[model samples]
Target: MGRLYQVTVVGFKGERVTVDLCNTEEQMSSMTVEQLKTKVVAKLKINTELSRISLIFADERLDDDSKLLKDYGVQHMSVVQLVLQVDGGRQL
Candidate 1:
């Protein structure tokens, strides 16, 4: 038997998107931050570079793509906040 959990991706104005799922605990832990971000971008239907997307969980910023979800102790049904970073310099 395997463990399955959901990770919801939320954006501005309560834009909810449930796109991350793991077939097993091991798989979930092995999943990297970048992988989740990619899924979010696709599910959210946003055309932006991977670097432009920032993920936040438990009031902590997930800035390392190479790090696994387990590194942050992501729990079942974890709510990940998506922040779309603007590219280039300021518009001043």
Candidate 2:
């Protein structure tokens, strides 16, 4: 069977956007959050440190080791938000 997941993309410098991805059961069950993070980074061309970013899988904080559709609690066709923390470009 195929699974549909809503992937939300957000960054400190850009507006939030959501994308949908379809994956097979095998693919969905085997992909880790870190792997998904890499995909997001690649698709978005994020050059900054990924450690500074927060990925909310289905509105919950995603564990780096958690799998996209297996370990993470995301509903079918649900939205997953990726947020990056920024300090408004000001130095303290």
- TM-scores, one per candidate: 0.85, 0.62
lDDT for 75 in candidate 2 is: 43
* Clash totals in order: 0, 0
What's the true lDDT of residue 50 in model 1?
Answer: 91
Runs in model 2 deviating more than 4 A are: 1-6, 10-23, 66-68, 86-92
Using TM-score as the measure, the top candidate is 1
Cand. 2 TM to true fold: 0.62
Summarize candidate 2's per-residue lDDT along 4-58 as a digit string, tens digits: 6556666445656555444675665676777666767777777867665667754
Query: lDDT of each model, Cα atoms only?
Result: 0.82, 0.62
